[model samples]
Target: MSRISHLFSGTALAICLPATAALADLTAEEVWADWQSYMSSAGYAVTASEVVGSGSVAVSDMTLTMEMDDASGGGAFEVVLETINFVEQGDGTVAIELPASTTMNMSFQPETGENVTVAVDFDQTAPNMVAAGDPGDLTYTYAAEAARMALQGVTIDGITVGPQIAKLDVTMTDLAQVVKTTVGTLRSVSQDMTIASVDYDLAFNDPESDDSFQMKGAMQGLKLDGTGKLPIASDVQNLNAMLNDGFQAAVTFTTTGGNYDLSFSSETDGSGTANATSTGAAFDVSIGPDGLLYDVSQTGVDMNMLLTELPLPLSFSAAEIGTRFLMPLQKSTEEQDFGIAVTLNEFSMSDVIWSLFDPTSQLPRDPATLVVDLSGKAKVLFDFLDPAQAAVLDQADTVPGELNAVTINKIELDAVGARLTGSGDFVFDNTDLATFDGVPRPEGAVDLTMVGANGLIDKLVGMSLLPEDQAMGARMMMGLFAVPGEGEDTLNSKIEVNDQGHVLANGQRIR
Candidate 1:
């Protein structure tokens, strides 16, 4: 019976041993230490006081700081957290709680040698973290909370400014990261955050005057999703190596496909008040390793100003407007590519505004439309963000890069009873700046077609809006460059600049 009992006991012990080996005992102190070391490896100076308990650890008086030195002058920033508690769970997980707020202080000086200081306050709820395997990989999930951020102090050029308050309601679904303790590398990170609303109040004193200004702004329903892979290592130093070493990240932000509003109003001590309001404004932006993509639109906008010195208030309104842009992320020695598109649809004016420019109302009351699309390539000499490189370019009195080529992919205008459409391509000669008075000389052609131009000009002349001599000169200039089109009041022209720096219309040299 004794032998049988020993055999059973040994068998049970073997089963338990395997299960225990699968989970290495992790303490709250160990995790906190690893976090501190990881941040230090990433070029931040960190300090903290720790107190250990049975299954938890509390860190107090934590501080992290970094500094930057550049042509725009040097700057430093520091963050201080009052107290943070890390509690270990039975399931091999840790919970981080920061019941107190955090403070960040930043000081910087511009090239003009003027100093500035900005202080901020931030707070968040506790987040749950689970360690994966023995490699220090952490997967964390934070509960949505109404976080508050405030700008406590701002000093610019030695002038002190008043405080600003902001409330941000944020929720994060996932915040996962792989942190290697041995090499101190944050290999990968992914997160999704939603901001329900952001309301702010700002006040500042004019540096050169005795007046003060106050503004209030608010934004609603913003969401951000991002994932990134970093090439960070313990030994990494420069940005070039960090970016070139298989680094890639993409982030996208939107408003949940719903209409949002952003509005602001400002008031001066003695200069009255100004207000601007926008409705149905939507924003979407995406960024990746290679490029950035953005789309912004607003359905309606209104602005009003009441000045103490002016007899009447100024106001204006627009029906719809938007813009889109896509550009490369990194600068290269070779040609870099970029594109931009702008659109203004259904633009209308108030009666008060119209009376100022056209009291007789001779122009048509139709809403105007303006659209443009442009793409181009350019060669960069150095990194524009680098202060040293920018200083060199500034001292030489030259642009950081030279345009290689540009294409007017599309241009359309429908306004004032006239419509114009055009497409063009041009190549710039960087070596011929002197010929164009410090501007790059272009050698290419653009073809344009206009409809209703003649009738529009006739109306202007009949209404006494334009002098007869000026109208005749304009017609003669059009006759010299453009030929009559097949349709009524239509004209077509090709505008060009030759290699010899001569401007031409059609096949004839005009200059």
Candidate 2:
């Protein structure tokens, strides 16, 4: 049996020291050899001074540098972290501290972007680095006035917001296994002549699996605030390259407990030929144990874009987007389960008619009040080798191919204040969609009912999706022939799709 003990001083961080005389059974050279062996096996290239300090163990400072290799290939690039003058506390922790007259240098390269180099110096005694206990305490500090960014041609809002210089002051405190960890703060100072005001702060903590994440700060207040119109050729080139030589907007979202909040905004103007601007937007939602609850609100968004020679000038403006919604997530292990809910909201859009239409009062004559309710669920996978989740494999990422056999239990959507509802359910065999090139395509049945036929038809006609004459004629036909199992005013329809992609309405295939 063996024992290891680490020292914890009250009001101070715990430090690693040589094991008590009980382990005195080993000599200094023997201990150093063991240390080197341990670090190498754990994937670190370790080096240290040979001179052993007084007493039995070889007590001396050491340096360690580690870098990842791409052989394991999960991501595109590898990670590299470097630390100089890392003193091994002999117990288990390591330290990198500097006296008043020390210099530091480090470089960082992202997955696919410009390289940033940072150099730091200290005019005072920096913080100490302690060992890693169940939770450990480690601190370091550096005076900035030496950081630089070399972004060849990056600009924002018509301003060349690159070729930057700045200084950073940082302090870090990490406590392992303990109840809490505190990372003090970071402060950055930039050159006085700098035109843009860009500020950023970020912090996070994940104590254990059972506990939730704690966020202390964020990456915010990064602004390119300048009133003068500036040359933005460099900015345009960089943006075009990043967007595959054009303009695009892509966003991803993740939610837990179906609750979230997000906000964004931007604006720009420059050169007589091109101009762009943006406004505030936000999304907020919460799903309580009671049921699903959500709220979304946004405002002031417009993109008046022009690419010469294009027939349709791209223009848009949004006054607001707001919604209140509720729904429940239900499930059962044995029986199939499903849930339903709806959202009540208003969304306003304005089409900019720069040439032929009035720019003022750009809002259309009719504002939209959108009401949508939806319900859906899936069946449990019964097969072990070929699961049901595989059936809809194309719809998701990280889905096991064996789970494709699972079938949809049911799905339904209600739109326009419940005036319309469409629903269907289906089962699928072990077949891949791509391979369906030869086999008969899967088949499914659908039922749709449109109530308030006359009013709905009028709304459709107003939107120009349906001509007034056609809408009136459809409503008149519904009046002449009553819907099966329903009244004359409602339009009831049945749809059947076969393996050959042929569709049928009311038992007649319309291929």
Candidate 3:
């Protein structure tokens, strides 16, 4: 006897074996029914026009619909699948396929105006889904060959605004998920997708003008990978509840290398061209109980552009650009902390572009850099994602929170022959906005040090980049606020805002 059979004995085997076998021997119809039930539980209305066969079932003209109501307007979305096929294998598995195209339509009804409709058409080549294992612990895999998609139509307030896409090709190699029936949850899911190429041409007539505008562009080699965990019970009906209860996800997108050439033309204003190339780019994002975090970085970015009616083209390049953001999760009316940083490294402009402003090339040709790091705390006034809360926020005149404190851990700028570095910590007095002309009053001092400013100004004056009168005015302003530093051609300054509404620079009252 098989080991599985050996685990059971005569009468006990007869009783429990059949039950276990029934759970393991899931049919195509059962799988489809379960999907329908699950979607319905998640607030979607699912329907199918025809369901044929038993073990190997084929469904036709299936649709899923969802509706959302908001203060600004209400919206409804419907997705239609032309056909789907499911074939049961003898090895306790079923193979599913979407053999035809899919279409989605969204309509929004504004509170005081007409409705708007947006439609999309998607194409695929029998993308497959394979399911296996027992009912309580099933696994499903999804994969697809290269496919195309395009925007079909768009209409707003009964006015047709045509939208189109010439071509978009996508391919997916790995996608999988595990479903746990006992807890009614998806244990985990992971996916990786690649966009092989994209070519597009779009045109729209100006509503107020007789002239029309058009744009054309192309790109290649974009990739995306993602993984997620849904700790909440999948059977939960409320979508917001699922997110609030337990949800964690992470996704990363990157470009393997690509070039894009975009051209824009207007019937009345001539035309322009822009070309860009990059070696690689990446963006990563995550969300969990700790809150949201994201990082974006790109390298080898080079661009050349000519604006309409411009005399010359502009060119620039950067070795790398990056930024990061973090916000702690706040589930209640409590204070939350956040951090942000930005970087611009090894950035430079072509001489042809720089000569327009600096004819003598007085500025240094070395690459420039700018970096900033900041962190702060604030009390969230409402649920940021809730439509009602958003409506309230939009109606308010100012942001609905008191900024407890802000710290500028680092601030650095390097360009031309000048370098500036500064750091500061500040506290805001939200109620004293009137003292700062409707802006939150800040009470603190920022210490700054600058190098090479005097030399840069002298060079600029010698190159005639700055008029003598303007240069004198600039020096006078600096003398009034900044004090001489220990180093040659260097200066130091302390900008302070006191509780008595006084603005001072280097111990001298300025305001």
Which 10-residue window in model 3 sums to the lowest lDDT?
A: 9-18
Most accurate candidate by lDDT: 3
Collision pairs in model 1: none
Given candidate 2, what's the lDDT at residue 86? 35
For each candidate, the alpha-carbon lDDT, in order, equals 0.62, 0.34, 0.66
Runs of candidate 1 exceeding 4 Å displacement? 1-43, 52-55, 70-72, 100-137, 152-186, 205-210, 228-251, 256-272, 280-299, 308-311, 319-333, 384-388, 395-400, 429-441, 497-503
The list of candidate 3 runs beyond 4 A from truth reads 1-30, 41-43, 50-53, 70-72, 100-121, 133-138, 151-221, 227-250, 267-270, 285-295, 322-332, 339-341, 389-399, 429-443, 484-487, 496-511
Candidate 1, residues 312-365, lDDT tens digits: the string is 777766676889887765568778777899988777766776776677887786
lDDT of 2 by residue, 392-427 (tens): 444555422221112222333333333555666443
Clashes of 3: 0
What would the per-residue lDDT of candidate 3 be over residues 275-305, giving only the tens digit for each residue?
8887888999987656688999878989999
- In candidate 1, where is summed lDDT lowest over 10 consecutive residues? 11-20
| Model 3 RMSD vs true structure | 9.5
Summed over model 2, clashes come to: 19
> Each model's TM-score, in the order given?
0.74, 0.35, 0.76
